[model samples]
Target chain A: MNIGTRSFQFHTPAVIIDQHTIAGPLEKQGNLTAEIDQFIPDLYDDEKTYELCYTKLIRQTVNILMSRHPLTTYLFTGDLINQSTPTHYGLMETLLVPVTFDHACATFGLSLQSAAFMLQQGQKQTVMVGTMSHFAAVEKQFRFPNEYGQQKPPSSQTTVTGGGFCILATEGEGPKITYATLGRVINAGFKDPYNMGEAMAPACFDTLLCHFQDCQVTPADYDYIITGDLGAVGQAILFDLLVHEGYQVNREQLIDAGCEIFKDHQPVMSGGSGAGCLSLFLLSHGIKHLFKQSLKVLVIATGALHSPVALLQTPIIPTIAHLVVIES
Target chain B: MNNKLFHTVAEKHNPPRPLLKNCVMSFIFGGVICAFGQCISLFYLYFFDFSEETVGDPTVATLILITMLLTGFGVYDKIAQIAGAGTMVPVTGFGNAVIASAIEHKSEGYVLGVGGNIFKLAGSVILFGVFASFVIALIKLILT
Candidate 1:
């Protein structure tokens, strides 16, 4: 389908899903689960109880989406497993057929490959790409560095929960994926986990240039562009770097969903991290009007590919972005 | 009638219509919004058995989401008009503006449409905030 002729329609059912799935794990984990139990005492009852609740939650979410778009095939995005654990992955896999999964190093390549594969297969009319993460699970698995010191960073409080789903149909009723281009991953092979902004710079520049080249669209052609989960510092660095390269984006139109999700009133000092951030924005605000108004939109979902293991060894974090074009 | 006495009588009989209405509406709407927040917090506390700390995150997220949805439905503008900065200054207010602005220009395409419009209301705020903070930091560095 030609980009101009296509009409894109998309829906985002973003809300808490499958809280019960994590319940058993929390109970099994014990220590942190006890701490969480203190806050949500009703959740502490039994290990099996949480599993039941989350299972129901997941079922409810699936049912809701199914009712809304019954024909759409589901795609589970990354961080369906919070810590890259087998159990988390298993739980997510049970909920939906896994098209593909990648963490840290190969996430971008795998995501693009899977997206391309789906587009080619043409088996499903509509594809739903969604992701969810429990902050408790993340905290339990990796003691978010901020929590280590005596004084916790203020941004720790607004930890997000919930899943975001975007329904992509082959019929081109919604925002069309104009270009899902993958830039060659430039591995800095650096090992510092705390400052991901520095490490991911090389990849960010490379991917961005590749995207611009692939679309034959210069930075000026875009009205506004949003990057997924670059946090505060990374965003700052991105803006500076882009300007240095002489491709200045209007600061107004250039938004970071992470920044929007973690408004100043909330204690989320940096910003939200995960697939949910980008998906929610696209569904809630991105597709709804942008598609209707005929405004061209570029939604870039960037991921910092760093595992706890990688962080322990080297601070360098691999990053990837899935760029989709939405036009009215 | 004496001029002073006449003025006093007019003032007593008729206060500004718009001003009075605005004051009343602000109080009622403001109270209602606050009450909703309180209700959500309490609900989390009671039914969900969530602690004060744990309840805050969900409550805040729910409020933001509600505001975002309202902005999507175009109901938030009416609420904002009635409440003025009372509704716009809070985090919920920010969400309302961001979503509403994006929705307002959603036809452009994701990159141009919603992405561009995402900052309609908060654009100035972010700009000024960053500029001011940077200036302040620079000044502090220079002075120290």
Candidate 2:
């Protein structure tokens, strides 16, 4: 049911039944390596092209989830690839009905929100929510050739090569999706493509504030408030924005998935940013932490909604963020 | 917050780049590449019957060959990240740009892919280089 503007409260909250996350070898250097269910071993994944490898990530993730939950009725998934081909092409064999959602790195949040709505409406029994992103494939589409010699600015983020999948049902014994706040396209008049965290931070702030207002809960109500793929810079900016708005933001409770995914040793300038960044961290690390104790977690997944063509037309990058409240 | 205020906050959070370090690194690595080229030119002068003027062509070819191999081996980008303009300002960077595009497009096909997109990055370099030279030549002729 609709709560306030841009927020929804699921009457019968959707529950996560099971989850499986896979990442590339580079992600093994991170702190959550043990939490990840599987690793792709390399970028190629025994495929001819990086595009095909991306498809493999989606295929393998869904196939694993489907095998665990054979009664899944639908697949809600997306990626950063052009036309979201990886999700469509990967699920060619899976009999589940596919619905593609694209909101850049926030694809996972969109997928989760929609899946929860479907569950609450009794439209589907089990919905498999998933998202994939490959470093080489996304680089070819968004930036430069893999072999091209280019220096990325400190604001730039590494596109994570991974996929995360989870099964959601109306009645299950797992994390419950209770509330979701849909974010509007917020353009803060920032234009640099390399500095995506800054471009997307305002959207995070908007959705987060909306979620707090609509849910009637303060930051202290939740054990943790996680933002998707904001990296180090955006995290700082988000803190400043919240504090400026007369809200007290606990530094320990507010963490970014991008900063959590990569260690300082990695060459990633800011940190990891991709559709999988949030999903991978949530499924792997966040979920485990929730199970350890009684906690309420707020996940605000953010995305920079601009294409190479769109960037050419308007240098400004418009961004969005989706908020999901998960409880143990 | 308004767009203007948000910009101020964003800028405040963004850490500045290490400009001095980049400049010093670029200068050192760029000099090293040039010194390596000089060694190749000197080798040609000693071992082969190439003059100072004629030596330019073979030396350039050798540098391009080395760059192409590095690009193919996936080693050039890592070095270029640290070297910055040091690796990019040289002719070798031009060769790597072309070869990198060709390799990236190989998955599409050799005919319309590699053949068509080979000059995608380097096309502007060639066009502008020739145009600038032509303009200089016309100026010289007029002065004579």
lDDT of 1 by residue, A50-84 (tens): 22332333344445565667665555555534443
True contacts kept of 1: 0.00
On a 0 to 100 scale, what is the lDDT of residue A85 in model 2?
Answer: 92
lDDT of 2: 0.90
Docking class of 2: high
What interface-residue Cα RMSD does candidate 2 give after superposition?
Answer: 1.0
lDDT of 2 by residue, A1-328 (tens): 8988989999989898899999999998887898999998899979999999999999988998888889887888788987899888988998988888779998889999999999988887789997889999999999888999988889899999896899999887899999999999998999888898899999999999988898787898998899999989998899888888888778998889899888998999999999999999989997776556777899998999999888989887999999999988
- C-alpha DockQ for predicted model 2: 0.84
True contacts kept of each: 0.00, 0.85
Off by over 4 Å in 1: A1-59, A80-95, A104-113, A144-159, A188-192, B1-144
Residues B29-101 of candidate 1: C-alpha lDDT, one tens digit per residue: 7678878999999988999978987898899899989887776664675566556545755677766656655
Query: What class would a CAPRI assessor give candidate 1's docking?
Result: incorrect
